[model samples]
Target chain A: MASDQKVLELNDLNVHYFTPRGAVIAVNHVNLYVKKGEIVGLVGESGCGKTTVAMSTLQMVSAPGRIVGGEIKIEGQNIVNLPEKELRKLRWSKLALIPQGAMNSLNPVTKIKEQMADGITAHEKISGAALRDKVLKLLNDVGLPERVYNMFPHELSGGMKQRVCIAMAVALNPAVIIADEPTSALDVIVQRVVAQTLLDVKNRLGVSMIMIGHDMGLLAQMVDRVAVMYAGNLVEVGPVGSIFEHPYHPYTQLLIDAIPSTKQKKPLKVTEGLTHDLRNPPPGCCFQFRCPFVRDACRQKPPEFKQMEPDHFVACVQYN
Target chain B: MGGLTRGYFIQRLLMFFLTIWIGVSLTFAIPRLSGSDPTTAMLLTMMNARGYVENADKIIAAYKESFGLNDPIGIQYIRYLWNVIHFDYGFSFAKFPAAAWSLVTPALPWTLGLLTVASVLSFIFGVTVGSLMGWRKTPRWLNNILPVSLTFTSIPYFMFGILLISIVAFKLHWLPATGGYSRDVNPGWNAPFIKDVLAHAIMPLISIVITSMGGWALGMRGLMIGVNNEDYFLLAQAKGLSPARVFFRYGIRNAILPALTAFALGIGSLIGGSILVEYIFAYPGTGYTLYRAIQEQDYTVIQTITNLIIIITATGVLILDLLYPLIDPRITYKKSVAS
Candidate 1:
C-alpha cells in the first residue's frame, strides 16, 4: 500500500496575484499528483501559471501573490496552511526544489562545499569531518569531482551548477522535488545531460519529481507522465506515451505539433484565438475561445475533467 | 586563491603606485601654474604689512637661490618628490621656524581618533538598518519605524551638530561647549583626559552618525532590494535555510559588494575629516586645522594636508581593488589566461 501511495497531491489548488485593479487568478482550481518514485512533467506556455503552481506547492508564493485555496499534501500531510516553523521543517526534509535558472540559482560569493553543507546543517546535527564527508559524497553522487568542493558557483559551469542543485535537492531525500523549468536556461547538449542527471537521481533515490517546462521534446524523453496546463488550468494529464500519441486537448495537440524534429520540416501551429483574461474567466469551457470545435453548448458552463480512458483525463465540452 | 591571481596582484600593485604618482604630480603642477612662488607670496604679504621695501628683486633672487627655486623645473620636481616621501617639509609659512610636520602632527591624532570611531559606527548602523529595511522578512512595525528614524538625514549634519551644541551644551550645560578636551584635564594617557575627550566627542559623533548613516542605509537598501529579487536569494529560502542564515550569508554577503566601494569613499572623507562639523564643534581635528590654514593663507600646511588626503584616498581605493576579488569571485577575470 505504501509503495503505491501518492507522494505529492495538489487538490483543487488555486493561486491568485493581488493587483491594484483586481486579483488575477494565476492558478485556477488545478488538481495533479506525483506518485512514489514518479517524475511528472508539467508543460505549459510561458506565463501560463505553471510556475505559480510550483510556488503554491512549496507554500512560497511571494507577496502580491497568495495561495487562496488548496491542499498541498506531501506524504499525506497537508501543508497549505501549515505554520512557518512547520513549513520550514517540511521543506528540504520532505519537499526539495531544483529551482529554475540553474545559472543563477547558486549564491555567487559562497564556496560550493559550504553552500551544499549549510542546507544539511540547517536540518541536522552533522559538523566538521562528517559534514565535509557528506558534502563530498553528495558531489561524488552527482558525478562532480572532489576538487569542486572548494570552488565557488562562478567557477563551475552551468551544467555543473544544475547538477549541484540536483545534488542539493536530494540531500535530505525529500518526498517531492518541484523542478521549475530546470532546463529552460541551458543549451541543448547540457540540457540533455542535466535531464539525464535528474532521471539518474530519481532512479537512484526513488524520489518523486514535478519537472516544469515548455519543451515538449525534453519532457517526452524524461518524464513518465505529462501534465499540460493552459492559462492556469490543468487541461490534460495522462501517461506520457499515450498523451503524445493521442493528445485529446486541442492545445496539447498544438503543443506537440510544434515540437521540432530532424526528419521533416513542419509549420509551427498557431492557435486560433487568445487566452481569456484570468481576472474574470468567461462562463464556459476555458478552451472555447481557442478550441477548433467551439459550439454554443461549450459556452453554457465551464467544463470539468471527464475521464477519457484508463489513467487519462481531459477537460472539454466534447469529452463531456 | 580567492581569485587574487598573481598577475592581478602585480597589476593592482602597479596601479596603486600609478594613482599616487599622478595625484602627487598634479599637486606639484597646480601651485607652479598659479605663478606664485613661496618667496613672492611671502614678499607680497610683507609689503601689505609694512607698506614699503628696498631691493625687493634682489631679496627675491637671494631667497630663490637659497631655496633651490633657481634650479631646473625637472630637478626641483624630483627634489620635491623626494622631500614629500621623507616628510621633510621645511617649516610652516604662518608659524616660521616650526616644521611643517610639527604643525600637522598634533592635529592628526585628534582627527584620526574621532573620525575613525564615528565612521565605523556610522557604517555598522547604516548596514544593519539598511539590510533590515531591504529584507522582506523584517517585521512590519520595524520597517515602518525605520524611515522615521532617518528624519535627521533630512537636516544637514552640520546643522544637526549646531542643534546638539545649542541644546546639549549651551542651553542644558550638559557638556563642554568646544575644544578637543577640557582645559582642566592634562593631555596624557590618564582616565580623566580620556573621559573628557570621549565626553566632548559624543555630540560630534552623534551628529555625524545620525545625519550621514542615512545615505549608507539608503544605498544598502537599494542593493539589498535588488539582491532580494535574485534567483539565488529565492532559492536560498526554498532550501529551507533559516531566516538568519539566508539574510546574512546569501543576502548581505552579495549586496555588500557595491556598498564596499561606497565605503572606500567614506574612508577617504574619514581621513580628511568633516570640516563643517569640526568647525562647528571646535573639535581641533584635521578638518578644523585645514580650515584655519585656509583662513591664514598658510600654503605649507594646506599643501601638506591636501597631499595627505589625496594619498589616503588613493590608498583606500587601492585596498578595495585588491580586496574585491576576495569578496566577489566574479572579479577574478584577469584576461591573462583563457577566461
Candidate 2:
C-alpha cells in the first residue's frame, strides 16, 4: 500500500505483561497494515493476543502490560512516542475504539447524552444545544431515537446498548475505529444486525477499521483482509478470500477446517495436542506441537514470515 | 421524566416518615415495656448508693405525679410523640429535674462539631488516597497505604481513644485531657473560646478520625479496584480522557456511589455521638449526657436521646435517597422491570 493510502500500520509490535512469576509475551513482533476505508479482521482464539493488538493500536493497555517495543502509526504519523497530551487530542477524533461487551461498556450511572457529550466535549468546546444536536445525529445514524438520550444503560435493551456504543465510537467521525468483538455479546439474530450496522457505519463514514473477533465465518463475510494469530504470533495474513480459500499456514488451514459446514455433516477437524504454556513458550513454531507436518527445523527454531503468494504472508517452514 | 422523578420523591418521602415513626414508637415502647416505674427506679438507685431509705414512698408518689408516670400507657405514648414533634421532652428525672431538651441541645453542637467535622475530613482524605492507591498504574509504594490503613482500623475505637489520651494528655501533657472547652473561659463565639474548644476536641477527633478513616479508605479502595476492572473504565481510558479525568470521572465517580450509604450512616452516628469516646474524654457531648442519664435512671432523657438518634439517622437516609437521582442516572422511581 502507498504511504498516504495506509491509515494504520503496526511494525515490529511487541507487547508483554509482567506478572510475579515472569513476563508473558502477549503480542510478539507482528506487522499489519490497513488501507483507508478497508476493514481488516484480527482473528484468534481467546488469549491469542488479538485483543492486545487492538488495545495497543490506541496505546490503551493497562498496568503491567506495556508495549515494550513497537511503532503504531496513524496517517503517516507515528503515535508510539506521542506524549499523552497529544495522544488525547488524536483519540476519538483521529482514532476511536468500540470495546467488547457493549452491555457493560457504558457507564451505568451515566445517561446516553452525557456519555456522548463526554467524548465530544473532551476534544471540542461543544455543549448544550450544539452537543445535543451532535449526539442526536450520531444516535440517529446508529438507528437510535432521541428518546434514548435521557435513558440510562439499564433502561436499554442489549442491542440498543450496542448501537449506543457504536454511536459513541463514531461520534467524532474518526478516521480509524478499532472494534473489539463488536457483535460477540449479542445473540445470533442480534449479532447479524449489529454486524450489519458496523459495516454500514464503516461504509457510510468511510473509516478504516480493525475488527477483533474469534469467529472466522463472521469475519470472512465482513472484512477485506484477515490476519490469523496463534499463541501471540501472527501465523498468516492475506486477503479474506485467499485466507478462506488457500490459507498458507497449517494453523490457519486447521482454523478454517474447524468451521462447521451446513450443506453436509462431517466429523469436526480438531487440532492435535494442547497449546503451549505462554509462561514457557516453545522456541520454535508455536504450532509445531499441533501441526501434522511438523519438521525437525520447525521444532528447533521459529520460522520467519515469508510471502507465499501475492499479498499472502504465512509463517511456516513449508512456505519458506 | 419529571413525573417519574416526582413519583420517586413522594415514594421516598413516605418511606422516610414511616421509618422515623416506627423507630420513635419502638424507642418509646422499649422503656415502658421494661415494666419498672422511672420514679421507683430512681429512688431505688439513690437508696442503694446511699444505704438508706427515708420517706421513699412520699418521694415515689411525688415523682409519679411530677413525671406523669401514672398516665395510661397508650395516652403516655401519644403525649410522648406529641412532645417529640415539638422537640419538647418535659423534665429529666435522672439529673436534678432539668428540661430534657436542654440536656440534648447543649451537647448537640459539641458532638456535631467534633465527630461530624472529623468524619467528613477523614472521608475526603481517605477517598482521595484510597482511589489513588487503587488505580492500576499507581506506583508500588502507594500499595503500602492499604496495610497501614488496615492496621489503624484493627485497633478498637475505645482502645485507640485511651492510648491517645494517655500518651498525648497524661504522658506529654501537650493537650487538655477532658471537657468540650476550658471551664476557665466562659463559652462564647470569641476566638479564644473557639481555640480552647478545638484543643479539647483534638484527642477525641484524632481517635475517631484515625480509627474510622481506615474503614472508609478500605471500603473505597475495594470499590475502586472493582470499578477499575469494569469495561466502562477501559472505554473511558480508550476515549483518551485525561488521566485525571479518567481517574476521577470514571473510576472514582462510580466507586463512590456504594460508599454514600456508609457516609450517611457515619453522619448519623456522629450526630448521635460515639458513646465510649465521649465517656472516656468526658467531652460534655450527647453521648456523655446519655451515659449519665443511664446511670441515674433518667427515662425522659433516655427516651428523648434515643428518639433523636433514630430521627437523625432516618433523616440522613431520606436526604441521601432523595439525592440519589442527581448523583446516578441509573436510579429512577419508574418501573424499570418492563425492559
Candidate 3:
C-alpha cells in the first residue's frame, strides 16, 4: 500500500524474445511490487510469461531474449542498463534466485558446501573457517544435516536438493529472492515439506520474495499476494484472499475453476481456444478471443486494471 | 555418493588384467596361425634368395630346438604368456640375438614424448577454442573466426604431416626433413641437443596439433552449447560470480567431462596411430622401429611392439575408469546406488 515500504518493484517491465521469425512479447508492461517481509505469487499456465518476469527481474534472460523496456528496482536501485561490473555486485547480495529444476540446479561436480559457499564468497569476501561456519549454518537452517555439506547433488534426494536451493537463496540475505516454481519438480509429500521450509525461512528472515509457480493449491498456502497473468498480461493483482475468493478477470476465474478439488468431484474445466500467436497478439484485450463475455469494446481496445476494492485490482471490461 | 568402493577397485583391476591377457593371447595365436615356425620361414626365404643352401634342413632343425619352436603348442603358449608377463620377448629374428625388449625400450621414450605432448597441446588449444565458439557470451569476432580453425579437422593428420614436410622441410628448407635431430647434436638433456630435438620436432608437432585440435574444438563446442543451457550454468550466471569463474568452474568444468574421456581414449592408441607420421619423418620412435621390423620380417620385434601397444591402451582405459568419479561426481563406482 506504501511505495516507501516497497522492497522490490517492476515498473512497466517489458521483455521480448527476438527469434528469426519475429519478436514475441514475453512480459508486457507489467508493474508489480513486493513489500518488505511478504511473499507474492506469480501464477499462470505454461508459456504465460511468469518465468520470463522472474528472469527479467534478475536481468538474466539469455541470448535472443532481451529486456526491451522497463526498470527492475531493488531497494530503489534500478537494475536495468546497469554496467556488468555493478550488476554483478547487486546480484546475490541484493537479489537472489532459487531457480526451477532443483534436479539440475546444482553443479554436479561440486560438493554442496562449495556450491553454497562460492555464492557467498562471490558477493562478500569470506573464506576458510569463517566461510565454512557460515555455510554449515545455512545447511542447518534448511533442515539438512551437517553431513549434506560434503555430498554431491546425485547423492541427495530430490526434496533435499530443493531444500539446499532454498538455503542458497537465503545465503546472502538478499532483499528479494525470485523462486521460480520452487516446488514444481517435487512429489506431493516432499512439496509440503519444502513449502514449509520456504515459509519458515521467510518468517525468520522477513525477506520479500516473488514466488513463480503454476500450482495454485501450493501457492494458496504460502503467498500473501497473488498476481494472475495470461497471454503475457497481468489480469489481476491483489490480496491472495481477494483473488481466490472473488476472481475478477474471466481467465482468473477459469484458472481457479480448473484446480482439482477433493470434496466436490467436477469435470475438469478447460477453455476451448488456444492463445493467439505471441508474435501477433490481437490489438484488443489479450483474452478477447477466449473471454466468454467478449464485447465490441473488448474487441476494439484493451482494458486496464481498475481498483475494485482497497488493495485489489482487476483488468477487464466488466470490472471497468 | 561417498566414493569408490574397494570392491569396485578390485573389479576394475581384474578387468584390466583380463584385457591384457586377451591381447597377449591374440598376438601369440596370430603367429602360430600362419602355419610355419619362424626357423622354417627363414630357411625357406634363404633358399629362395640363393636357389640353394648346404645342409638347410639340419640348420633349421638346430635353430628350432635352440629357439624352443620345437615344443608343443600348449607348452609354447604358456611359456610365451610367462615371458610377456615379464616383458621378455626373447630375440629379434632378423637382427639375430638382439633382445626384442632392448630394441623396444629405446624407442618407447621418443614415441611417448612426441604423442603425449602433441595430444595434450591439441586438447588444451582445441577445447579452449571450441568452448569459446559454443558459448553465447563469446565475442562476435571470435565465433565468426573459430569455424575457420575446424577446416583443418577434415584433413587427415598424416596427410597434414606430409604436406608440412614437403612445404616447410624439403621445399622451404626451414627444418630437417628426416630425422629426430641433427647428427652432430649428441642426444642428451643439454641445451644444444634439446634445441636440435625440438627444432626437428617442430614440423611433426605442427602437423599433429593443427590437424587434431580442431576435433577437440568441435567436440568441446557441442558440449559447451549443452552446458550453456543447463540450469547450473544459468544459476552460475545469476549468482553474480565473475565471468571467468563461471566459465571455468561451472561452464567448461562440467562440459569437459565427456571430452576428457574421449581424450583418454585418443591417448590409448596414440603410438599405434603415429606410425605414418613417424615413417614420414623417419623419427626414431617405436612407430618407426615397428615399421622397419615389419619390412624386415622381424617377428619378435613386431610382436613386442604390439604387446606394448595393448598394455598402454589398457592402462589408459583403466586409469580413466578409476578417475571418472573424481572428474564428474555423478559418475561413481559405488554399489547399491545412493539416491
Candidate 4:
C-alpha cells in the first residue's frame, strides 16, 4: 500500500438498493484500493455486491439504488459528491468501464465506428475525419481488423464484440478502467486471448484496472492482487500469490480449493450450501452460515476486517 | 434480395385475396342468417296494417328484382366479388345518386387526417413521459400525474368525443360542430377549403388525443421499466453516459420496439375505431358514411365499404410486417437468414 502508487481508493463504502420489501444493503463497509499499473480482482459469486461496487465507483447505479456511505477517491479527487456534469467530464477522460455482456453493449442499429465516436464525443469536441482516424487506431490497437468499423453489432461474433467493448473503454486513455467479467461469455481460447489482450493493453498504456470476475483461476492469471468477496463482504484481500498459496479466510481457502487441477485425478471440491441471501444476512459474519468452522462467538457480532500480515487482510474472528 | 422481396410480395397478395373472400362471405351470410328478410317483413307489416295486400306484393317483387335477391348465394357472392375487384360499386340506396365508394371516399381523408395525426402525437408524448418516469427509479412529483393520465385512457372514446364536442363545439363555439368543411366553400384542393376541413377536425382530434394518449404513456412506461432492467442499459450507464442519453437512446430505443408493434396494429384497425368518433363529430369520414348506409339497409354500399376496409387493413398489416426487418435486423422473414 504505497501512498504514491495508489490510483484509486475506496473507504468504508456501503451501497443499498431500496426494494418494495425494504432496503437491502448490497455492499457493506467495504474498503479497498488499486495502485497504478495493477489489476485488483474483485472475486465473488453472483449477488455478492461485486458488480454493485464496480457500478458505484462510476456513479452508474440506477433508481432505488444509492451509495449510502463511502468515499471514492480517484487520483486524490473524491468523486462521490462531484456533480453529474463535473463527474461526466472525468469519465472516459479519467475513468472508464468495460461492462458485462459484450453482445448487447453496442447499439445494434449503429456501426462499431459510430459507437466509438459516441464515446469520444461524450468528453471531447472532435468529429468527422479526425474522429474516424482516432476510431480506426483504437480498433487496430485492440487487435481488431479495420473492417470492423463498418460492421453493425449483430454482424460481429461474441469475442469480437468483447474486443470492441474493450476498444471503446480504452478509447479515451483513462487512468483507471473497470472491467466487469470481461471474459465470462467467451470460449476458453477466446478467454485466454482476451485476458492476454487486457494485460497487453495495460502494459502498452500503463493504465490501472479493477477486474471483477468469479473465476479465481482466471483472476490468478490476469490480476496482480485478488479480493475475495462472500455475501456482501470482502472475506480476504492480498497479493494473488499470497491469497492463492496461503489463504487465511476459510471462504478464500474454499474458493482456491474449488479450482480444478490438471495433476489431481480426483474431482474438484465443491462448497456446500447456497450463497446467503442478502435480504436477511446472518447476525454476525455474512458467511457464518456457510463456513465449516462457525462457532458461538461467530454469531454474536460481525468480525471487523483485520490485517493478518503486512499486505494480507481477512474479515473472520477465526483469524484472531 | 430480389428473391426475398418477390416472396414477400407474393405472400402479401395471397393474404389480401383471403381477407376479401372472408369479408364478402361474412357480409352475405350475416344478413341472411339474421333470419328475417327486411323487404318481406316490411311488406307483411304493411299488409297487416290494412294497406293494400296486392300493392304490397307488387312492391316486394320489384324490390327483390332490383336487388337480384332471387339469385343463388354463390352467384350473388361472385357478382359482389367481381364488382369489388372492378371498383364499380353501384349507386348507394341511402344516397340514391352517389356511388358507394364516392360517398365513402370523401370522408376517408378527413378521418385519416384527424386520427393519424392525433394518434402519432399522443404516442410520441406518451413515450417521452413514460421513458423519463421509468428511467428515474424513484417516485417523483411527475409520477403522481400518471393516474390522471390513466383515467383519461380508461374513458371510452365516444363519451370523450361527446364531452369535447359539447364543451368546445357547442358551449365555447370554438370549432365547427359537423361536416368536414363549410358549405360556403367548394370542396376543392385549396387553402380555404383545407382550413375549413381542419377547423371541422378539431373536436375529433381532441377526443382522440385525450382518450388514446394515456395507453401509450402506460405502455411506454411499462416497456421502459423492463428495458431499464436489461444489462446493456446498466452497461451504458457504467460507461458514464448521461442519464438523458442513456434513458432516451438506450432505454427508449429498446422499450419503443414493443410500442411500435402496437402502432402497427393500430394502423391496421384505424378505420374500425374511427366509426364512433366520426359519427359523433359529423366529420363526414368513412365511418359516418358507412353508418348511414347501414341504417338505410343499403346492402350494396355496405358490402363495398366492408371490402374496402378489409383491403386497406390487409395492406397496412403487410406494410407493418415489412417494416419490422428495417427497424430491427434481428427479425428476419426466414429462420435460415442471419439477422
Candidate 5:
C-alpha cells in the first residue's frame, strides 16, 4: 500500500543557476518524496544537483540560484512561495540541514552549548537552566558528553565537531533532517561512528531524513530508499534493496557495478565519457551520450519517469 | 591564567618594554644628529630680530652650559633618557622662559579630549552601519552610500578640516572657528567654560570623525561581506536563525574582529594628531604646539612631545595585544606538544 503521509514532497522541482555563462539548469523537473520516518538517500556524483535539491528543500539556495518553478511541500504546506519570516520558523524546527564540512559549518567563536541553544531558543522561550538542560539533552542524544557544552569549535576534534552539528540539527526536534555528506571529511572509523550516531538519533526521534552522498555503498547500508541521479536528472529510485539488487536504469547499473564488492572477485568497472556540461546540456536523455543502451528515440527528447514496479521509478525511453 | 595563555602574556610584556626602549632611544638620537645647536639658533633668530648681536655671545654660552649642550653626544643621550624617566625635558625655547613640561602638559588634555571621543564615536557608528550594509543585499539606491563613504575617506584629513571650517565655521556660522575656549571665558570647571572648549573642538573633531569613520565603514563592510559568505553563515540561516540574529550574532561578531584590530593599530595615528586641522583651528593641541616648536627651533619641546606620542602609541599596541586573547579564545600562544 502507498503511504499518503509524507514529511517532504518535491513536485516537478526545477532550480536554475544564473551564471555568466547563462542560466544553467541545476535541477530539471525532478520529483522526489520522503514518507514519515523514512530515510531517503540522494546518491549522485558531484555537480549532479544532489546538494542543490537538498538546499532547495529548505529554500536555502543563495543568490544567482533560484527555484524558478516547482512546489516544495513540507507536511503538505507548499514552501516555494513562503514568506521569509514564515520560512525561518519552518527551518531548524521543522526542516534542518546538517551541512557538509561539519567542522567548519559551526561558528568557531561560539561554544557548543550556546550555538545549539541558539536554534532552540529562536522559536521557544527557554532560559537559564531549561536552556542548558535542553542543549545537554540533545548533545547526549547524539552520543556526545556534557563536557562539550563549554568548548569552542576549535577545541573539539573533527568527529566531535560533526557530532555537535548533528546535535544542533535535531535540537528543535525537526520533522525532517537533511544530512549532506555528513561523514565525508572524517576518518573511516570516525565516519562509521558519526554515521551510526546520526542513524541512532533519527531512529530515536522518528524523524524523516534525506541523506545526500556520492557513496552509494554507505547509503545502501543506511537508507531505506535511494534515489540515484545523473546530470541533474533522477535516473532511478526505489527501495534500497531493489535499487541495489535490480537497478533498472543503465546509470544506476553502472554505479552499482563500479562499487568494489567482496562477493565478486572481478575488477572494478569504470564508466566512460564526461558528464554533460550544466551550462549547455544536450537535449533528450541526460545520460544518452554515455548510456550503453541508447536508442534513436532517446535523442528526440528527455525521457519521462515511468513506473517499472509497485514502488520503483525510472526515467528512460527503454522503460517506457 | 592557564599555562597556554601565560606564554602569550609574557611575550607581550617583553614586547611592550622593547618597543618603548627603541622609541625613546630614537627620539633622543634624532635631534642631536640633525646638526643644529638649539641655543645658538634661538639666539641668532631672536637676537637678530631684536638687533642685539653685541650680547649674543655671552647669552649663547650661558644657555648652552645650562642646557648641557656641551656634553658628549652619548652622555647627553643617557642624561636625556634619565630625564624622560623622571618626566623632565629642560625648557621651551619657543615659549622663552617656560619649561617644556608646562607647554606640553597643558596642550595634552585638549588633544586627548577631542581625538578619543571622536574615534570612539566614529567606530561605533561606522561599524553598525557598515555591518548592516554588508548583511543585506540592499537596493541599488542604498548602495550609493558606499561611493559617498569612499569619497569622504579619499579626501586628505586636513583638507576636509579646512573645507568644514570654511563652510560650517566661516560661512554658516554654525560653530566657533578657532581656539580651545573663548578668550572671554576663564579656565575653570564651570558649565560655560566647558561648553566653550567643546565648541572650539567641533571643527577638528568633525574633520577626524568624518575621514576616519568613512575608512572604518568601508573596511567593516568588506569584512562583513566576506564573512556573510562563509559556510557557517549559510548553515546558520539553514538552522532557521532569524535574519536579525544571524546578522548580529554571526555576521557582525566575526566581521568586527578586523575592525577592532584596525582601530587599535589606528591609535598611533591619533596620537600624532590631525596636524593641519589643529593648525587651522588654532586649537592648543600637541600638533599645534609641535608646529610652533618646529618653526621656532624649540628642540626641547619638540623632543619631549615626539617621545610622548611614541610612548602612548606603544601603550596602545600593548593594550591591543592583551585584548586579542580576551575577545577571541582561539588565539592561544601555547606550542603544541609532540606526542
Candidate 6:
C-alpha cells in the first residue's frame, strides 16, 4: 500500500567515495521508494551505507563521496541530472534533512527565533510580523514554549535544541524529511519525546519521512516500512510488521535477534563476526562468512533480491 | 548587582596597581643590582680637567640633591607612584626643561596611526586569503600556494622590515629611506602633510603586512579547516545553504573566533611594535621619544611611557577577555576558575 504511493523513487543508486586508498563503494546499487505521508525506515549497522543513501537523496554528500551512478526522482522529476542551483531549490522546500546530532546543529550565537527566521527567509519572501508570527508558530508546533524563540541554543537543554532542529527542518513544510539518527544522542525519555514530536509533526503536516537508524525497535515505533541494509547493499525490505515478524534475510534475522527483549527468558541471540569491509567486499554473499545458514552456493554467487510475498523482498540463498 | 560589579572592578584595579608596582621595583633595582652607579657616570662625564682632585662624596651629595636621589627608597617609590597616578612625568635629563609627557603625547598618534592601519590591513587580507584556501579543497592551486604562504608568515617582522628598507628604500630609492616626512614640511593634519606621512609609511606598512599577514592566514586557515569538519557546517550544507553563506556564516564565524582573540591580543602589542618601527623609520613617535629618554636615563619619562604601555595593553586584554563570553557562551568565569 505504501510502496504504491511512492513520493521518492531511487533507481539503482550507487555512491562511491574517492579515498587515498582507492574508490570505496559506500552504497552499491541500492533501490528504494518512500511514499507520500508515510515514514520509511532505513536500518543498518554502522558504516552500512544507510546514512550515505539518505545523504545522497539530498545531494548533501561532501567531497570524496560522489553519487557516481543512478537516478533520484522526487515527485517523478529526475533530480540527479538537475543542476546544483535547481537541486538547492528542492532542498528545505521539497526535501528537508534533520541531520545527525541535532543537539549541536543550531548556531550558538544566534537566537532560536533568528535561526528559524534564517530558514524561513532562505526560501520565502515573508518578513516583519509575518515572519515573526511564522517563527513563533513553528516554535509552538514543536511543543516548545514561545519564549524559547528569544533564547540562544546554548541556553536550551539538549532536548529543547533537538526540538528546535526539528522545527527548523519542518519550517518550510517540505514533502520529504530525512532524519538521520535524530534521537541517538538523547536519553531514552528524551528520545521518546523527540520521536513522538517527529511523529506528531509528520501526522499534522502530512510530510513523508525517511527515518535512518540502527535500532529496529526505535524505527519500529515510527516507520511504516523498513529497508534493511548490509555491507553497502539493501538485503531486505518489507512492511514494518512483516519484516519484524518474519524477517527472511539472514542479516535481518540477526539484526532482529540482537534486539534485547524483557519478555524472553533465554539469552539474547548475538551475531558473530563484524560487518564486511566495503573496500574489498566479498564477490558473493557479503554476509556469508557471518551467516549461520551459509551454503556452498552462497559463496559462489550473490543472491538477487526475490519477493516471497507482495512488497516483502529478501536477498539470500537460503530463501531462494 | 552594582556593588558586586563594583567589587569586581575594584579587584581588577588592585591587580593593575600591583602589576605597576612590581614593574617599577624591578626597573629601579635592576640598575642598582648591575653595580652601575648613575652618580659615578654623571661625575665622570662632568669632569673635564685631567687628574683634577675630585671630592667624590661632595660630588655624590650634589648629584643626589639635584636629582632627588637623596630620598629614601620607600619615599622615592611613593613619590614616583604619586607622580605616575597624576600623569606628571618630570623633565627629560637628555633635554632638560622639556616635559617627558609632552614629548610622548605628540609621538603617540603617529605610531598608533601607522600600526593600526598596517595591522588591520594585513589581518583582513590574511583572513580572506586563508579562509578561501581552507574552504575550497579541490583547487590544486590553493594546495600549492598554502605552504609558500605559511613560510612567508613564519619569518620575523623585523627581518621583513630590514629587507623592505634595503630593497625599497635604499637600493630602489622608490621610497624615502628614513624620517617620518621630508624636512621641509611641518607635520600637520593637511593633505600634503598626510601624503608625506603616508609616503614615508609605505615601506614600513608593507614590511608589517608581509610579516603579519602569513600568521593571520595560517591561523585562519587552520581554524577554517577545523570548522569545516564540524557537524554544524555539514548541517548547514544539508539545509541547502549556498556555499558562500556556509563558508562565511557558519564556517567563518566559528573559525574566526580564535583569530578574533589573537587579533585582540595583537591590538595591545601594536603599541609595543609602534616604538620599534617608528625608531627604525626615524618617525617622531612615542617610541623614538622613549628611546631618547632611555639614552639620557630620564627616570620620570621612562616610568610614564612604560606605565602608559602597560595600561593600554592591560585594558585591551581586559576588553578581549570580556568579549570571549559574548562570542562563545561556553566561556565563563566558572570555567576559568575550574581550570
Output the number of the DockQ-best candidate: 3
Candidate 3 lDDT for residue A307: 93
Query: In candidate 1, what are the lDDT values of residues A35-126, reduced to their tens digit?
Result: 99888999999889998998889888989999988798888889988989888888889888888888899999989998898889999999
Model 3 chain B scores worst on lDDT over the 10 consecutive residues at B330-339
Sort candidate 3 into its docking category.
medium
Clash-forming residue pairs, model 2: none
* Tens digits of lDDT, candidate 3, B225-255: 9999999999988999989999999999988
Ranking by DockQ: 3, 1, 2, 5, 4, 6
lDDT of 6 by residue, B1-339 (tens): 001244445555676567666765675566657777676665555564354536977978886787677788788777777777777767765455788788778878877888889989999989987887778533688677666765656667767777788988888988897777898887778898888888998977877787788888878888888877776777777677677777777888788888988787677566656566667777776778777778877665776677777777666666766566666655544412311
Q: What's the interface RMS deviation of candidate 2?
A: 1.7
Per-prediction TM-score to the true structure, in the order listed? 0.96, 0.92, 0.95, 0.87, 0.91, 0.90
For model 6, residues A157-272, the per-residue Cα lDDT tens digits are 88888998899899999889999999999999999999999999998988899999988889998899999988788999998999989999978888888888888765554457
Model 4 CA deviation exceeding 4 Å by range:
A1-4, A20-22, A261-284, B1-81, B93-98, B137-139, B176-196, B242-244, B334-339
Q: lDDT: which is higher, 3 or 6?
A: 3
Docking class of 1: medium
Q: What's the residue-level lDDT of A278 in candidate 4?
A: 73
Where does model 5 exceed 4 Å of error?
A1-4, A257-272, B1-11, B33-65, B69-75, B137-151, B334-339
List, residue by residue over A1-320, the lDDT tens digit for candidate 4: 22347889999998899999888889988999999888899998888899999988988776578999989999988899788788878887888888788677777655778778877888888988999999999889889999898877877888888888888888888989999999998899999888888888888988899999999899999888899888778889998898888899888888888887788765444457677667677788877777888899899899988887768898898866
Model 1 chain A: lowest-lDDT 10 consecutive positions:
A1-10
lDDT of 2 by residue, B1-339 (tens): 322377798899899889989998898888777887777777877888899989999999987887677899888889888988998888887666688888889988888778788888789878877787778867678776555665777898889989998999999999999888887887888989988988998889888888877778878888999999999999887787778888888888899998987888766676556889998898888988888888877877887888888888888898888887778866667775636
Worst 10 residues of 4 chain B by lDDT: B1-10
Instruction: State candidate 6's TM-score.
Output: 0.90
Indicate the worst ten consecutive residues by lDDT in candidate 5 chain A: A264-273
Residue B252 in candidate 1, Cα distance off native in Å: 0.7
Cα lDDT tens digits, model 1, B96-125, are 788877888898888888988988888889
Best by lDDT: 3
List fnat, each candidate.
0.71, 0.74, 0.88, 0.38, 0.65, 0.44
